[model samples]
Target: MLIGTVGNEPYQRVSSDNGPYEGAMLGAAIGAGGAGAGIFGARMHYKGIDNRAKRHISAIESREPVIQRKINKVNEQAENPRMSFIQKAKSKIADSGINQINNLRTAQLDSLNSKNEQLRNVVDSMQHTNPNVANEADLSRRSHYAQSYADINSHYDDVIQGSRFSKMKQQVDQSMEHKQARIEKNRDVKVSRLNKELEKLSDGRHKWGEDGVKLMKQKHPYAHVKGIGRSAAAIGAGALIGGGAGMILGGLTDEVNKHVKQ
Candidate 1:
């Protein structure tokens, strides 16, 4: 009985020692697996943050050029007088659906205004500097200049479409053309009659040739009126025709080449 009990005691102790060893090995394996998973998760998180920062930097670099270009354009505009003039004129003469015409008008007005201001300022400065220059003769000359300025301004007032001023100017021009034509036609008829009368007066004058025959009765001023009347009539008719031709050309030029495109 004593030998059997000692044998049983060694077997029980062996079983107890085997349980603790197996448990320790399993616990070590679980700890190693958890540590590896945490390391992988931390690496993934840091890499995602790095990629996001790179994309943000790239986006900022792309937009920087557009912003810089606008700033440069503004700086150029601030320094340029011609550009400022164009902008001012454009504000005055803009319209829908006609950018080219508006730009042309802006340029034209800019040039015209700049020239006018320069001339005006020079005159003002001269008068201010030399009081002696403002004598009677000088004042008369200045008055004449002012009259010339008024005449030029009267010729080309800004007559926008759909305005009463435009309608009035058009009507006045038409009336002037009609009246001038009538005067020209009447003068032509009068000249033709005078030429016929001269031929009758110098019918038998041997001293006067065909061309000079109109001057036959030079001494008889009261007795014959042919030469003088005929010559005056011819000159008047020539003047009328020349003026009419000039008027036609001027009208055509005005229509084809407008001062203001808009």
Candidate 2:
């Protein structure tokens, strides 16, 4: 009877504890596994995000040189050259009183030349119609007109010769100056935009990197701690139950020996 009780007692002890022990171990394993996985995944994800941020920062930095190259190209294209002699003279002679008088005289001379034939025909008709007035008037009018035309033509020739190259050079130089100014203005705006974009990328990269570091600090160690705590608790409880079972088995063995001895 003692041997049978001992055998049945050991069976009942195992049957009673088996489910709870297995349950505790399973729960601990799942908890620890989940925590470990969470820690690992979080770390990996943080690394991925960090790498992407770094790449973004690098890409932004790379564009700085490209922008600089564009600026350099524009500067090269728009470089100022020294003024030519004609350009200098044009700058000196512009809008002066002498130049205005010369322009007006040249215009009058051109108009007089256009109407010369008609004026000569009217003078000849008048000489036929009124001989006395024509005889006196014709000599003075022709003499005065010819002398004035000659003097004005000579002055216009001088003015044109002095100003022709100057005018053309001034036009060409002004065009270059205007184009350079436009390019410089556009370059300034482009550089400003690039700088803003680069700053934005830098700021974004820094923020993301800092956040990743903080998240790693928060998640990785915490996950490990949780996993270790749960696992340790399960292991300790299993040990305690096993020790109690050993004590019970020892007592049952002693009783069985006593019954055999009797």
Candidate 3:
């Protein structure tokens, strides 16, 4: 049995021997065990949240390089211009025309060479068979073939350097330049957009990491403290209930023994 006082008021005797002390010790042990389990669970939960956030951040960061590569590819393509279909067709036509002109020049030159060779043979025969006739013959006429060859070459040059051919070539070049300019402009816009997206992603990753750290710092400790508080409350409640029950049982036993003795 035990007796105590609270605030100048004398409390009733607790009939069970060591009832309050044993119950309190038992309740505290149980509460501590429960608190430890709750703490472990809370810690695991916090760790899981942190790890999940980190994984999400890592995933976002991985996409950063992929987007950057796309930007680089776009820029590279912009640097190297591609001819349009129309321009390519025009160029092919121009080349064909030039080939035809060259073929004609070659045929004319070959014919002139054949005629010149026949004249040379005649001159050689005259010089060997009749020296007087060879001297009297207008040998300067042989130079006409060389002049004709030069004229054919000049005509070829004139056709190649003609205004029509030059204009066609210039148009093709201008078209390609225009196409390249458009590509470069589009690449600039696209690259700018991608760069902005990368910036946003970088910011998001940073914020996510910071928020995860902040959340863990703020919530984990609070959760642990809350669990501890609940366990403390459980201990107090269990002790109070157990001690009251033990005292009641002890008083009943004392009364029963007394009656048996009587």
What tens-digit string does per-residue lDDT give for candidate 1 at 29-74?
3344444454445445544543554454455455556555654554
Question: What are the runs in model 3 whose C-alpha is more than 4 Å off?
Answer: 1-47, 99-158, 208-227, 230-262
Please, what is the TM-score per model?
0.22, 0.35, 0.46
TM-score of 3: 0.46
Go through the candidates in order and give the C-alpha RMSD of each one to the true structure: 56.0, 17.1, 14.4
Highest lDDT model number? 3
**Prediction 2 TM-score vs. true:** 0.35
Instruction: Compose the digit string of candidate 3's lDDT tens values, residues 8-72.
Output: 11111333333344434444444455556656666677667767778879889799989989998
* Residue-wise C-alpha lDDT for candidate 2, range 1-262, written one tens digit per residue: 5556556543334433453344334444445555456555655765576576677667767776786686666566556544557656665565353467577886898887767766677778997689888766777678878987998878765775577544654575686687678867876787677678667766765654667556655664444444556656644555555555544544555655567779
Could you tell me the C-alpha RMSD of candidate 2 in Å? Answer: 17.1
CA lDDT, candidate 3, residue 251: 50
* Candidate closest to the true structure, highest TM-score: 3
lDDT-based ranking, best first?
3, 2, 1
